[model samples]
Target chain A: MLVIVVFVLVGIVTALLWASLDAFGGNVEQTAGVYSTIIFFVLLVGTLVTPAVSGGAINGDRDAGTLATTQVTLATTGQIVLAKFLAAWTVALTFLAASLPAMLFTVLAGGVRLDTLAASLGVLVLELGVVAAVGVGLSGVIARPLFSVVTTYLVVAALSIGTLIAFTLGGLAVQTERTQTYIGIDFSVGGEFDPVTGLPEEIVCLEPETYSYPVPRFDLVWGILAANPYIVLADAAPTTFTSEGYPEDLFGQIALGVRSAQLPIVFDEVIDECGAALAGDPNSAYEFETPQEIFDRTVPSWFVGLAIHLVLAIAALAAAVARTRTPAGRLPTGSRVA
Target chain B: MTSTAAIAVEGVARSFGDVHAVRQADFEAASGQVTALIGPNGSGKTTLLLMLATLLQPDAGTIRIAGHDPVADPRAVRRVMGWMPDVLGSWAALTVRGALETTGRLYELGPADARTRANELIELVGLETLADQPARVLSRGQKQRLSLARALVHRPSVLLLDEPASGLDPAARVDLRVLVRRLAAEGCAVVVSSHVLAELDEMADTAVYLDHGATASAERIERSRATARDWRVRALDPAALAAALEAESIVTSGTDHLGALVTVSGEAEAAAVLERLVRAGIAVSAFGPAVGDLEHTYLDLARGEVAEQPVIDSTEAPR
Candidate 1:
């Protein structure tokens, strides 16, 4: 709850501060949109802290000498493991449930549709559950509470958000580029670049038919860019992100939700000679194509978030349960060590 | 023969890497009788108890609770057996009561039954006041009592106690002794292992003395009790009972050689011999029945000539 309040309140207050200072010519609506992005920050911090704090609960109990009493009795290992897993998973669920208001705030600002919100939350729950399970399994292997927590979190992060994330994005990159070529995105792009370099040294304007070295940043370019999937998904949520991807691409799409790495470029702006085109947008002259499929393809953010959270919670619970299922004599507790 | 040994352990053996914890050990705790498993520190008394409890499967030989095989059908054997380990190990947060209650619940007692058993055994072990305290707060004595309560909570007919007197003060030791006596009286087969030999002298009907992981000796419940040997004494001088016994003669020499200060090692029918002495005109001061002090006799028997130790070749089949 404290984490939720801190992140959400700061988002609102920072946006209000920007509006008050007239940072973007006193655009209140734009400031509201920026402030409402609090949902992302809440999940980001939650992902890191959840796995750190309660991840070592089973190992902690073993260290505390409680496991031995259970082991020597009629209590089987399964019962022991289930009990520990539930206790840790409950903490993760509590944090997610308590922070509901902040999630709603993003919806009110129109940045997240109801479906996107639900899907995002669903993914968050699953991802975080997997993290928790990984932590628990590591706890059994390590036998020390502190080491379990550190190693589980590191391993979970590496698998879920580290290397796998980069691979997922790179795969999504090929997927989106292929989809755009067939979906009339080629008409808007005007001439292809080297498939290897992808560093388009110069880009041609869609409306003016003029070639330029630096791409003019604009709302259309920022929202519809092929490189940043989150931006393309947000504007063309229900369609663009889904149209060209395989059925299994749902996994890559979910990973994209937790990744904030792509958003910087989406929000970065280049002062174009033509009254500062929107971030990464090439020009203002081209007619922006607003497809309804965009909103349709945007998987619900809440569901995505919920999935991540669920995965993490389940994984932690499973690992904890497995640890508990081990024979008392075999458990990591110092007692019955032989 | 005995009606049916409640616990029959025949040549049970267990080993760790290089250590022989239990070997060629044959022991039995008969129904409605208390058997004392007395041994030294590494004598394997507790290991034999564990086999009776079915907590350990023997590396060789067989053990049973009543007629149930302890190794092959442990669950059935378990229902009839209660085991109290030596160290209760409650130097943690959970209290004696909590540990006992949790243990009871694990055996699948109904909630109400578990609670009732927990409370009953708590009071039984004299830990009613400390029920809610964490285990870590308990003293060593309190922990052992709680562990005993936990073991007895299931009302098992066969109870295997590994050093039940451990961590107990003198008064508590006496109390525990009385409790074990009562349990045996109630027809529960009990095998109590203890380093304190004297406590088992009065409490145990049978004594199975273990030495170096094997049965050094097995004495019947009655024989182990050692009712004193009867003796007839006739002093040559009136009021000379002490001096006459101390005088260096065949009787005194025999007693001294056997480490017995007073020469009293024959059976009750020595009255005939006394009559012969009286007929010979020897003045008799007093003639009375004498019973051996088992504790003292045990100490003497333990000293040397262990050549008298019983050796049972080919232990009978378990159960």
Candidate 2:
């Protein structure tokens, strides 16, 4: 099943990559955005979906009633629990690995740097560990496999959907642009997010609509959820937050004719296009933003959230395995049968 | 200790909370033969079997399989003792081969060896056609057979079958008896617990009669003659045999296996005893000493027994 999931994931990403391949005009910035788009879907789909599938594995075996017989054997509770989680995680990773070559293209196109890829992989490993933990823990305590599966999935769903919805409603992000904003955008410090250039996204938008497009995990779009450090750092500087006309002094000539007339810049564009301002008066930018600055970038925000999820998942797995080892709950079998 | 003892229980006892299930139960099974443990329900046969399987520990007494203590050397005992529980917990979702393979692996069989053993067991249980079928779909008899196959897959030195034939039909039960006999022939000590008298009578070489959670009585039946009286009487006139019994010197007893009216000679000569019968104004009959039988005595003893003993906990039962 793990192998199957990998193939399916690969197929989907390959199809998406194949379809979009002819469309990328060799622009580094545009390619980075595409990279971000691909990873966004992978994490959401893999981390969220895999837990639900693996959550009920051991519980299902118990429900089928082989536990007592198996218990009498030399196999320990740890073996069974670990096997179930591994099977589930392996299947999910298959899908993640399937898209490896396709994801590599984003690097080739300069959508995201190799360090960003490495860091994102770290986040992925952590996310999977949490997913496997949810399945293992739920299966150990819950008798009904369906209940375990449903319950774990609901947990994953609540984390993914709930975080996005809550953060959006709380005004932490632009509400109108959902998963789409993450596409072809780089919110990371060095990412070119411009859709036309296919590179990591630069902080060029003061408002939601003018924000840098997704460049996979390299951009601040990932920070909207994961809390990556670079995204946190980028958001700390206020030069890109209020000075709308100051981004990229070189692109100012191009910015003049962006909207029609002298359009008022949004907060996103002010922060995004502040390179022009830095060239003129670097000190004129916003300073000492602190924690509030984190929300303005992608990596810091997304990683922080990702860390919380991973911690919760790992805790759940440890608890489940520990309980399975001792199974001291039934005080009635001895009393009745003896 | 009996030389043919397959499994022996010595001073075994177990208690759960305030209730005691077995107390001071002594048991033994002979090698290369079937020993039946017979008792009323709740007599702790299952508990004792489980203790022997190393699934539980008896609170007192020790269980030894071929001289090795189950509690002290469970790993070694586990490799040699096969247990078929009263209830078969079906690996319902797993195919027959898949489930057996898992157990084989746990028994430490190499992959190729496990497959080979699994195939042999599948055929032994006559499940070759259903080797890939899910356990959940099998009939009750088929499930029992599958469980039996699983227990025997390791070719253990001792086989503990707790009511292995309970749900089986008559024909299936016959097949079971044959299989068990074959196992015993291969030098395996087989301890089979059952409530069925006829089945045990046909299969067991020895009977451990469990009464009130202890070994109330035990008997080994080989080619030994019954201990009950056996008599041969020759009547000069078979029609007048009852009349001759009224004579003073000849004391009459009950009828013999040949349906003849039997009489005992009281130290008198054979002719004198016959003459005494003839003098009673009746026809004379010939008589001899009577031998004994065991089957009827065994049944009578079993009928007088009851259940009062507790089962030994898996942690403390004796070997």
Number of the top lDDT candidate: 2
Cα lDDT of model 1 by residue, A9-106, tens digit: 55575456445546555233343334334434444555566667566656666565445434445665556665555555566666666656555553
lDDT (Cα, 0-100) at B120 in candidate 2: 92
Clashes of each: 95, 127
Tens digits of per-residue lDDT for model 2, B1-319 = 6544556678887655554556667878877988887766666676667677765667888777877777676667767778787766777777899878878897788898889999999988888889999988999888898889888777888998989988899999899999999999999999898877678878887777664456654443221223333344556665566555543534546565454544433324545655655565554344554432233333444444413234333332221
TM-score of chain A of 2: 0.56
Tens digit per residue, CA lDDT, model 2, A1-338: 65466556755765675467647554544554456556555666676667667877766655554554565556665776777778888877766787677677666756465654666566665676677778778877665667777888877766656644543444434333322221122245655454664444444323333345422221223233343222221222121112333322111221121111112223332332244333443234434332223323312234456666667766766666655542222223322111
Show the lowest summed lDDT stretch of 10 residues, model 1 chain A.
A176-185
lDDT of 1 by residue, B74-98 (tens): 6677677787777465436556666
DockQ score for model 2: 0.15
Question: Where is model 2 chain A poorest over a 10-residue stretch in terms of lDDT?
Answer: A250-259
